[model samples]
Target: MARLNFVLLIAVVFSALYLVRTQYESRRLYVELEKASAQSRKLTTEKERLQVEKRAEATPLKIEKLARDRLQMRTTTPAITQYVEYKTAPAVQKASHE
Candidate 1:
């Protein structure tokens, strides 16, 4: 009877320890999940901010300014325009044998 009681006690102790370990792991994983969610939110906000900045940077006026300033481009004018002519061989008229 004493041996049976000892065995039962050991089993109960092991079960309690297993339950505690499980709870601890669950809490740890929950904390990690919260951290990951927070990071995700932060990254999403950063992405939105970057997208706004990108749109602002890509405006047409800004592009034109950059082109003129950085690339030394100039607007086209009729004074500087050139015309090109393309010449092709005259078509050969085939003699028709009646």
Candidate 2:
């Protein structure tokens, strides 16, 4: 009867240790989950800020300024315009039909 009592005591100790390990693992996983959620929130906020900057950068006046300053471009005026004319040869058209 003492041997049976000793076995039961050992079993209880093992059960308590197992419960402690399970609780530790659960708490660790919860901490990791919270960290990941916080990181996601930070990244989302950064993305929104970048999107706002992108929108501001895409305004037409800024594009025009960038074009004029960076690309040395200007609005078209007839004084600086050139015209082109296209005339297809009759010989080339006849060959394509064959």
lDDT of 2 at 71: 100
Please provide, for model 2 over 11-58, each residue's C-alpha lDDT reduced to its tens digit, 9 standing for 90 to 100: 999999999999999999999999999999999999999999999999
Q: Which stretches of candidate 1 lie over 4 Å from their true place?
A: 83-98
Candidate 2 residue 26 C-alpha distance from true site, Å = 0.8
Candidate lDDT (C-alpha), each: 0.99, 0.97
Residues 5-48 of candidate 1: C-alpha lDDT, one tens digit per residue? 99999999999999999999999999999999999999999999
TM values, all candidates = 0.81, 0.82
Q: What is the lDDT of residue 64 in candidate 1?
A: 96
